[model samples]
Target: MMVCIRRLFLLLGMIATPAIASPTISVLTDSLEHPWGLAFLPEGDVLVTERPGRLQRIELATGRQTIIPGTPTVSASGQGGLLDIALHPNFADNRWVYLTWAGHCETGTATHLGRGRLVGNALEDFETLFVATPCVDSGRHFGSRIVFDTNGYLFMTTGDRGERDRAQDLTDHNGAVLRLNDNGSIPSDNPFVDDPRGADAIYSYGHRNPQGVAIYPDTGALWIHEHGPRGGDEINLPVPGGNFGWPKVTYGREYWGPQIGEESIPGMVDPIYQWTPSIAPSGMAFYRGDLFVGALVQTHLAHLELNGETVTQETQLLSELNRRIRAIAQGPDNLLYLLTDQRNGELLRLSP
Candidate 1:
């Protein structure tokens, strides 16, 4: 009888496999041209950013797209384009919005964080809030992901601009997590405020190219996942004033042949999770919902979860969705939404 029950279970597994909609995909908006970032407003409208520096609004119910005017021009070169979009904490009352993009600098080009008032249907009072110091001409490695902490401080990640040594430079803002007040002022409580070696805005350093950043709703801890050189993607929990050893102490190599650095570093913080042979992780989010009971607790995200780390007995989704996922966020309906990266990208919705 036990053998017969086991055989019945096996048959049920096979029958239920193909029809299960894991990482369930649904099109929120179709015919969108290179949508990079998405932020839902209080009234259920979503503001999406196009890579070529255009902002648009999509009504959730109607699926209508309207282009927002008065957006700033961006450099739009190799990996340098309109990036993350975030709404101000008090957006409903304040009508403010923030954006990050690669902008033109006097020397060359650099990533800039700008804020403005989102009037009834247009963006007004555009202001360049923060410009990365010592702008370089290289258009690559513009890590412009943005997130707001519990204290209403803005955190932005900047890449090393294809220069590995810049990750270790204290004076340089590249390859560092920068903390700023809402209006782009350095907080007096920031770590390294008086350190002559490092900039005051530098909260933590030694990152390759962090794209995904989200605050843990339960613990208020800041979590990030960055792309590795050739392999060795990392999920890190950043502490205040901590030094995350990048090229100096990486699980990855130089993409040519040499090792990155020694494994034993005294003061450097090691990643809690590391993936070898690379998942090309771009965006991350912590799942907190009741849709998948007995699963989905502090689940770190990636496009694929072949060798993922999780605290619950969750199943791997998106096994066949062969695409580089760029962003993930929770929607108003308690469902998960994701954006795929490609020439013809897609906005996907997921459920249990």
Candidate 2:
């Protein structure tokens, strides 16, 4: 394993006082090689995916980690490698685990989804489910995040490989949100299932390196957020068969600060929230626990504060952490867990 040095330390971004109390942050563990995603098992252990290509379980009680044997030989260069991890909706009974990663494609690498059964400390019956089409040599943009909606369908994001033109081409699988069955079959009701104009598995299109995907369990509303070029980081509510207008109608500009395209077009959907100067948003989760009260108590979308498809109030929660947050997951206990993107990624616990 290649080791990179990064230290995880405490940060109090907001000062605490008698009238206003800020959430406390604690370092749970460290020494993770750019940990990319996180999942909690039925037994209460937390699963982590290191971008360097390792899957490990961390004991919540002790922070002790056990490397789970049997991960695919992932392409671990650039922004590729092991990405997102999710358990079957019925994980307790079936023990099925799903993973999204970068794999060897026709010439270079492509985003792939696979599933295996976790038995003891190893994965068994591993199989590839889906591979994003058009293998590109670039290692920059593989937007691989997996989520299961209430109806038990899988949705995964695919980036455009930094190729701007392909995002506008429906025939290409790049830059789209795809809907598939648990077994990797295209969902019959997917927007493009019968349309010869686009990939049958695609649900929506024109995305730019989306890194976060989550479904509101109660509402079953799907939400996604992605990175913009320089400015224009955005959170979006994706609709079936809808066009998001990446290179054509983005609020972002080119790397050197030249405008990319118009800010709005007729058919392209607009983002609910846009961040200029790019905070580099990665992973996000809607709060689903009893730990939060007052401003969050039974409120609708308090953290990101989303009302339907729009964000009302947003707060900066981790400015003091001084690290790029790669993923966020709300544990069963309502405590929010954060994975920092670093050579030595740290597991952080945020509590009110």
Best by TM-score: 2
lDDT of 2 by residue, 90-112 (tens): 99998888999988987788899
Off by over 4 Å in 1: 1-23, 289-316
The per-model lDDT (C-alpha) reads: 0.74, 0.78
In model 1, the worst 10-residue window by lDDT is 289-298
- Screening candidate 2 with a backbone cut-off below 3 angstroms (N, C-alpha, C), the clashing residue pairs are none
Q: Which stretches of candidate 2 lie over 4 Å from their true place?
A: 1-23, 288-303
TM-score between candidate 1 and the true structure = 0.86
What is the clash count of model 2?
Answer: 0
Task: Report how far off residue 236 is in candidate 1 (Å).
Answer: 1.1
- Kindly report the root-mean-square deviation of model 2 from the true structure over all alpha carbons: 6.3
Query: Relative to the unseen true structure, what is the C-alpha lDDT of residue 302 in candidate 1, on a scale of 0 to 100?
Result: 36
